[model samples]
Target: MNFLIRLLVTALAAMVTAYILPGVNIKDFTSALILALVLAILNLLVKPILVLLTLPATILTLGLFLLVINAVIILLAARLVKGFSVDGFFWALIFSVVLTVVSSIMHSIAGGNND
Candidate 1:
């Protein structure tokens, strides 16, 4: 299905990103898949609330505060997922940015519908 393909693409992106970033580690492809799922869940359930609560700061920072929120999500996933870890907040931020870029590229290459 489309969802499965997207998940695979995301997992590949996460694995590639983790391999590129020294401070981020994913134990294996399975861990990358789990990481992708956790990130999707967090983005669906938590991101909206976070964006709502941080509206003022987000507005003040010209929407850049979303980057911090993305880092927080990564840190949270690191804690929740057994084989995935980010060294610290700084690493989390870097990992998040890199992951986004990698994911976008992978999705585009995969012809994933922009869902």
Candidate 2:
């Protein structure tokens, strides 16, 4: 299914992030899979509400605040998923950014939706 493919891509992205970002540590493939699942769920279930709540700030910041929101979401996912560690807020921010970029590139190359 497409959902499973997306999850796999996300897990791959997490692994790539762990390799590239020093502060993001994924203990194993299992941890990467878990982190990817949590991130996908958070993006689906929580991100819209957050975007709505932060609409004013998002507008003020010209959409830059979404990066902060994404970092916070990644931090939350790190907390929820075992064996996946994000060193600190700054690390989480960097991890989130790298993951986003890598995932986007992979998705596009794979001819998948960015959802």
Candidate 3:
């Protein structure tokens, strides 16, 4: 199904991010998949509430604040998922950005929505 495909896409992206960034460590493909699933679930369940709560800052920063929100969410996922770890907030931020970029590129090549 579409959800499974997206999960796999995210897992691939997570793997690529871990490969490219020294501060990110994913034990294996299965760990990447688990991290991806947790991230997706957190983004789905918590991101909206965060966005709504931070609407003022988001508007003030011209939407750039969403990047910080995303980084925080990634850190949350790293904490929740075993065998996946981000060294620090800086690494978490970098990992999230890398994941987004990789996933976007992969989805573009696959003809699917990156989100």
Candidate 4:
């Protein structure tokens, strides 16, 4: 139940991100939900391994490299999900940032935990 609420909030955030970010395109509610689910799964499963693998670079970059890794993950999600598209590399980066911000705000407003 909590997870379902979080997922719905995430999907809403994705839809909002798509509305605000020109480069990010989510065709419909279903696409937005799918994209949000995929993104959450990727962040949960793949991002930790990626963070560990790039720990040195992340340290060297003073944690800034995490942004690049996030962008890459968002690009991967966009590629994996149909009807959810990011225009280009630059767009993917911007969309990633927007998505993160929107999701964070939504989660906080909904009293969801970061965990």
- Evaluated with lDDT, which candidate comes out highest? 1
What local distance difference test score does each model get?
0.93, 0.90, 0.90, 0.88
Q: Model 2 over residues 20-95: C-alpha lDDT tens digits? A: 9888899999989888889989999999999999999999999999999998998899889999988898998888
Best-fitting candidate, scored by TM-score: 1
lDDT tens readout by residue for model 1, 22-111: 999999999999999999999999999999999999999999999999999999999999999999999999998998898889888888
Please provide TM-scores, in order, for all candidate models, with all chains considered together: 0.96, 0.92, 0.94, 0.91
**Higher-scoring candidate on lDDT, 3 or 4:** 3
How many residue-pair clashes does candidate 4 contain?
0
What digit string (tens of lDDT, one per residue) describes model 3 on residues 38-60?
Answer: 98889999999999999999999
- Ten contiguous residues minimizing lDDT sum, candidate 4: 106-115
- Residues 11-114 of candidate 4: C-alpha lDDT, one tens digit per residue: 99888988998888999999988987898899999999999999999999999999999889989998999999988888888887887788888888888865
Better of 1 and 2 by TM-score: 1
After superposition on all CA atoms, how large is the RMSD of candidate 3?
1.6
Clashing pairs in 1: none
Steric clash pairs (candidate 3): none
When summed lDDT is taken over every stretch of 10 residues in candidate 3, the lowest stretch is 106-115
